[model samples]
Target: MTTANLPDLHDLRERTRQFAQARDWEQFHTPKNLAMALSVEVAELAEHFQWLQTGAATELDDGKRTAIRHELADVLLYLVQLADKMQVDLHAAAVEKMALNAIKYPADTVRGDARKYNEY
Candidate 1:
């Protein structure tokens, strides 16, 4: 779908589910497999920036950018699939995690610092 008509998270998840079901692939989409696939996709995404200078990754050529985009999409798709299989709402989990992170790394104290939360 076009970016202007992009589906919501739930819709996207449902599409992914249906795609897998059509191929009878759900049996291979266990949490473990999905998580591993996510990890591999992330690594593939990282490979595009493996030797780039600090900020160069953001300035990729069209071809590289497209490749990175596909890798990122793959990672996201697997993550959504895994979360669905585990009966977790990815959006809710992310929000809850962010809330905990805010407490662990209070902005006022952590601002401009790169240290771990325990060091703040």
Candidate 2:
């Protein structure tokens, strides 16, 4: 379905559940496997920019942009699917994780610093 016509997260999760069940794929979608798949999709997404010239990369035509967008959506879909499979609230988890990161790397302390979080 088009993203503009996409269902809410709960509905999306249910749809994914039904899809997986129909194909008997739920057993194959273990957390570890799903996580690995997500990582692979992310790598593929990154590959789109492997060696493009600075200006050329940003000047992608409609078709190129659409391809990149599809790759990005693939990555995100797998991510959300994984989260749903694990019964984790993706949005809440993201917000909570970012909150923890903020404490771990307070902007004032790390503003101009180039150190890792542990070093900060």
Candidate 3:
């Protein structure tokens, strides 16, 4: 999808920066710390689905869904902070990765296949 279809990531990044600065948290928001926090948030998000048989959208109750949403927000916040500290443009990196992925996994050749790019 085009960036026009995306939310204002730059705005989000600025907001994250302001939030950390206001709290004097920048000293703690090193890329390594942010990465670790991101991992923890991801694990929390995953825990919400740990026991689900299929982990389908329909499988989540309202409370569980709400918890998952908060976990996801935490993950995004950490990622934004991490990108800022690491001097990386998260959206641009994602777009570049998508381009690389297209080269690595051509749709026509990998259609209905579940193998690694190198194996294909």
Candidate 4:
């Protein structure tokens, strides 16, 4: 779906919270557990590209793309739940991180380079 049609992060967070509450699953959604689940979801997402070269990966069939989409949704859901449990504003944190990254890896200096900030 397009960004304009999507629910804001706060709404998504509340919806996720209600989902867990309805299922009585909030007790299992501690930061640590959510983090582990998020990691597992990431691994599952990566599995789709495990054997494919970078160029070939971009040419995945519709089924693989659908699977990747679901995996991505799972990742986002887990992250939203984790952020709720931790009382962190995901949007704000992401913005702050981008600002920090800019300072750590200035575009002009880091252009065409993939090295870490210190490595450059």
Residues 7-119, model 2: lDDT tens digits? 57766677777888999999999999999999999998778777777527556878777778999988877888899878899878989999998999999889999899887
lDDT of 4 by residue, 1-120 (tens): 654466689778878988889999988999999999999999999998887878275679989989999999999999999998889999999999999999999999999999999997
Q: Write the per-residue lDDT of candidate 3 for residues 51-119, one digit (tens) a residue.
A: 899888899999998999999999988888888888899889999999999999999999999999999
Q: Which parts of model 3 have CA positions greater than 4 angstroms off?
A: 1-7
> In candidate 2, what residue range of length 10 has the lowest lDDT sum?
1-10
Q: Using Cα atoms with residue i matched to residue i, what is each candidate's TM-score against the true structure?
A: 0.90, 0.78, 0.91, 0.90
Candidate with best lDDT: 4
Tell me which of candidates 2 and 3 scores higher on TM-score. Answer: 3
In model 4, state the lDDT of residue 115.
Answer: 97
Off by over 4 Å in 1: 1-7, 55-58
Residue pairs in candidate 2 whose N, alpha carbon or C atoms collide under 3 angstroms: none
Question: Which ranges in model 4 have alpha carbons more than 4 Å from their true place?
Answer: 1-7, 55-58
The true-structure Cα RMSD of candidate 3 reads 4.0
Using TM-score as the measure, what is the rank order of every candidate, best first? 3, 4, 1, 2
Deviation of model 3 at 110, angstroms: 0.6
